[model samples]
Target chain A: MSASPNQATDSDRSEVTAGIAAVLHPAARGAAREVPDAPPRGRTAWSLLGLSGIGFGLLAVSIVVSVRIGTSGVSYGDLGRSLGSRLGVAEPLPRLLDSLIWDLRVPRVLMAAVVGALLAVCGAVLQAVTRNALADPYLLGVSHGASTGAVLVVVLAIGAGSLGVTGGAFVGALVSFGLLMLLLRRSGLDSVRVVLTGVVVGQLFAAVTSLVLMASGDADATRAITYWLLGSMASARWGVVIVCAIVAALGLAVVWWYSAALDAFSFGADTAASLGINVRRTRIMLLVVTALLTSVAVASVGAIGFVGLIVPHGVRFLVGPLHRALLPFAALAGAVFLVWTDALARVSFAPQEVPVGVFTALIGVPLFLFVLRRRGEL
Target chain B: MRITVEDLSWAVSGTGILCDIDANVTSGETVGLIGPNGSGKSSLLRCIAGLRAPTSGAIRYETSDIHGWSARQIAQYVAFVEQALDSDSDLRVADVVALGRTPFRDRWRGLSHTDRAIIDAALAQVGLADLRSRGWKTLSGGERQRAHIARALAQQPWGIVLDEPTNHLDVRHQLELMRLLTDTDQTVLIALHDLSLAARFCDRLLLLHRGTLVATGPPEDVLTPDRLRDVFEVDAEIGQDSLGHLTVAYRGTA
Candidate 1:
């Protein structure tokens, strides 16, 4: 039963798996997991749902705690005024409530949540797009680059004021992103290469920052740079909080819209292309959005570490690689995580606040270790 | 749909892969291409599917050159299942099959009911209707392969391309998968290492050696002892099965 070339099929494909049965060798000598029907599907779904629910629950708790934080203080009328208004309690049981709700507590909570969600969402998308578990926004040197720019404005008086620091940080982020593209084009944007390059660049900028600090004669400027390096939400006025939230929301929307493309990417570049995805274009878009999210978040929070690297990995164990599911869960989890971390930072030493980034790093490293051990990847 | 490959040559990383080759395949027909390792079998297949561009040839589908065609455009006529056994995440069997319809989907639209129905039919065709809801990563190797084949089938392409789809399947599934294609409307292009299997089922054969076309004819003409020794460097016994189909048995080295 043969036909001429003219009668052959249009596909003209080769390597047909015509006749080979891989016997399920119950004892294939060294088989890790049997290939058929090994892992439970329902359990994964159930766990993802449960974890998301808990995430929301955590967000609620965080919001409540953030509102209550300034209630105990005597100097702050903000919390008490807001609490009195909320409870319909008699008159002014201390006006700490109004100040807390309007100026410090509420705005700080929102900024932390916005930064955390931005980081976590970007992290989740990055990991999926690059097909690596360790991908994060800061893997491109944006964080350190921003830091160098902000440090210059603070310690070297290059900007000579607060406004210049933010603008310089934004410009620094753009320049580093461009440098990353130029230096790493040949290898095809590998996740490991990008992250390692970022680390190297980060050290270079760290040296620059050190040089500036050592040369500075102003103690107050040096202290400001030091505090900023540590990262905090203490400076989140309502205006800054609004900007952070807007950026995070817009960035998250872009990521959410491209979730389908992200899902396709996990299968490999060739497969995704065969499915009609413009892989290169989509990747470029993802990189841009994540960078925007990173710059805005870093600018607001002054380089809070660990949230971006750690939250998405924790969420992935529960959710798998579907970006639509992974992203929302990661966002909620991140907000909750940063909220609690920020709260702990504020309350740990009481009047003397710890830098939230320090607390996040200290707690994040162990959790990260535990997750790695659980995954057997260590 | 009909495809014509005219004087095709392919180069990769400055190395020649496929040199001066030509072939044709029609819609709703079953054909086979047989070759040894590194004979550019996969590369040729990729070029046909528009997944890769040939250095000096045009693969035309339905009279349209696939040279500059997007993967999505070519996908409408051809669905390719690669040789690798792979599954990511805990996606269900049905979900994997439905992914084949991605190219057919409007940019922002969700899966249509027709898409789901086609996926269901594909699952049924592969004898996995009962397992449609099963998670992909949990399936047996054979089952996973079937699931991918089903996915290609769901795309409703004019022909389906299989790249060593039977590498991991045992004899039973091997027969089942081959048999599954017998009555289908979609044409089949399969690359096989086993000459006997190719002889028993393939309607036509296109044989390659050293990235060049060595022979093209009936299994009887193509699977001869002389050609086997010349191209594959193996001595083999060729005969007829009780079903009057060509059958081959490898004897030894050339």
Candidate 2:
């Protein structure tokens, strides 16, 4: 008899493989099962790294191509010159084109990529902690809370500029998250309670937003607030982009560090505890981190939908469920996905730029349905 | 490791689930816990495994009091297999077994070669190495139980605690699992509903009736006809079979 699987011979391996086949497909005796293949040990890591390299390559192409798609007639040549002159390698372009390429287009595209990555990562963390497949960044009501705060600032003329609105939105998000935490203080942060409480909070904030809109009776302010709530990258600037990038990078790193712990949570709280996880503390910490990331994103832009809900599920289908491989791939795929979608939003109507959020849903619904059909859920 | 429970009592709201119970499991002893339904067997096991804090009692694993120890520290000494634990994820058999290495892992490192070796050994012990890549959803009830046992084995703990582990297993699987439990070197405390299986396999038996430890000793002494009638509400005869195995023949309800 073979002692260990590592020491087994070719014949022994075949026998084991045959046994697996028989178990997986009872009706069709020797046929292979169509289940998602678990990446085999040694070379799997290298292959994942290679795939990440390709993803990065695609993201770079997306950024360059998106930067060129506007009514301003700026081409890839103009983009390269602007970037090269900034790095002291090539001659500077005309002043108007330089600012257009260097300041406006660059910041907007980068913001889209960063927000997409951040939302997707937050969604993955929430889904793992709550063990719910439909979880996303907005599941905590942070986006609705942000919308209410922004509306109040816009209609009443609160502090000062866009900075004031951003600040108000961030504060509003934190307050809603604080209420959620207070409600979950005594409970174990179980799946059903977290989800139901989130829905209730979201509804409360949404109602407040509508009430403020109706009371103002000013059509222009209402229109502006509604456009912002639907989500746009037209307001993207260097300061906002830098802040989102810093927060997103840091948040992704933190979530990646807890990848193994997330995998242990598949069986529920008690099983995770028996495997040495501090279930309550881990759940609280992850919820807080995800909420903070989401608050920053919704404050900078509006409540962008679908990136968070769609990307993690799609990536899991390709990489299997271990978060070690899932998180990074989801981040890269999300960055590429948003850059192209934002480009489409800019050119879809030529003179009028649609909200990128609208396009995200316009594209996300069909893609999500495709993923479900592939998984045989439909 | 020896497990000691000193005057353990647990209560929920205002009602008591377990009350002033004391027991000990010496090193390498296989102790069977037997009682009727709702006899506090599951509560007692949870308290011992550090999953629940008792209302009044102290549990000691070896010499250290487990009052302030974190869940990780407790897991390094004792592995617990819960009854009817299932998942709806895409975790494979190997992935499930790798969970047992959670206590020994650092924050930044993947599983080392030593960890993989131990996982392989655990799977081989439970005869599931051939199905390492098989999905959890595709497995039968018996295979799932065996995989969970393999997970406990991969923990390399000094003791293992189980609650109704054989509940949905077929008869052959039940016998195999008992044989494996008896063969292992780790100390075991198991809750059981099958009296004959318990009598034939366990080194000693502990009987609980309505949150009290009514009897504890060798199987024959603790499982007397009068105790069975009173505690379990069953009329039975206790004797040996022709094959020289201790058996319990139940007549009917008392």
Candidate 3:
């Protein structure tokens, strides 16, 4: 029927309304189809879990081994005795070696692991939210912002009375993130725009940092700024380690909670929205969480480059692209990687410790290139 | 489910995209949304699916206004598939289909036995059971489209809304997809560029012309030569095939 103006009247309405009653039921057509003889859980889950277990094992070994291999070179027996005494399971070692392992190396190594885990998780989440493979906290200007805040304190002595480098870095990271959020809110958080904004903001802050250091003309202040800029766990204390550990754990828990939604995002925003995800709210929440994680890591030990950028990609190659597996695996891999890299930095140049960031870039650039080449992902 | 659109209009920055569109898709009816490019067919589908809000109209799913429902609530009844899904993800095909179960799944819970059965059935229905473990990037264009259909099927929704589902499909797959949609008991609202397929498969057609509803009725009523020439700007001869399906023969652009 043509559904002319007259025919669209009340008589046809009754017939159309009659059809509504049977409409809302689920289709019964596919229920009787023979399901293939596949395992319900599949091998992928078990394999990923096994790989994650291996990653954690490597992290533990890295921490224990790296703790012993530092410049002081405590023997394995002394290391065991030192750990045993700390746990109150055995007789204590001599005062010097005990303090060296329990006091210095243990916390430093632990901080490296925490920072690595934080940065890597942050990178993974950011990459998912922005839908950019290359996204990382450092590349997005979050780390540079923390550097600006830390440098502002060290050079200008703005927070000399109360806020130290860590406090300054935290505030700087938030402020920079606040600016990024503002820009995103205004311009609608497109992936390319976010990366472009981060790059521009990072360069602007870097220039200001340079100008301040050049104008101050103070060698000691410049040295301190340079060391912090290149990132180090040299100043790692028990307090910083504890705080970072808490932040990293909390951040990981939150990211894990949204891991399913994050997987939806890999399909793009429109598809994510169709999957009943509140795309805008989820993106904002994940971005803020990532910024907070990046800030905590940077504030505690400056900005360690490439862990965030490279760890997720490396882990993705191992576990595929599911965020549920990628996030945790990346965290474990990052922890193990940074612990060894910090150890190498300590011994690579002997008396003068090279910045861990330098080693990270040196190793990370090559590894990243290799991964890209292997995946054929430009 | 029955979808009743009452004076639905969508505008962007004061520019109209869909203007005063009114239509009714009855229960289990496969309604084709036919329009040329930029004529607002996709926008109307988005609004109906609750992915976009209409500027000043109401879309009722059954007796409830979908505008006031949460995205999850709306998704429980209506599933929308986009024309082309562009993703760089390396997820396996099974994982991609598992995303359809998201609206039913809790944040902490993994797929249950029932969910797995439904997902498997959907994959089988789409002829992708053998390729469930294949990487998403490895699938051909037609396979990708079928995978998306399988995803919608996994949702177990009461109604399925699709935007240009046949855009990338070859002729065989395109016909297969339309056949599948017509065979389903679920109410379907699909936007299509291929008029002959729409004429053959759709029970009813809503013809949109430059952001307005130009015509609405059964295929034979809506696919007339005058209506095709007016809305699609094409001269077409229409006839009934041996199976009583309406066939359109396009001569040239008007």
Chain A TM-score across all models, in listed order: 0.79, 0.88, 0.89
Please give the TM-score for the first chain of candidate 2.
0.88
Docking class of 2: incorrect
lDDT of 2 by residue, A257-290 (tens): 8888898888888778888788888888889999
Kindly report the docking quality category of candidate 3: acceptable
In candidate 3, how many Å is residue A123 off?
Answer: 1.1
Q: Where is model 3 more than 4 Å wrong at Cα? A: A1-31, A36-42, A160-163, B240-244
TM-score of chain B of each: 0.96, 0.98, 0.97
Tens-place lDDT digits, model 3, residues B17-126: 99999899988899999999999998899999888999998998876677666676666667889997868878888888888888777677677666677677778777
The better-scoring model by DockQ among 1 and 3 is 3
Top lDDT prediction, candidate number? 2
Q: Report the number of the highest-TM-score candidate.
A: 3
TM-score of each candidate structure, all chains considered together: 0.82, 0.90, 0.93
Candidates ranked by lDDT:
2, 3, 1
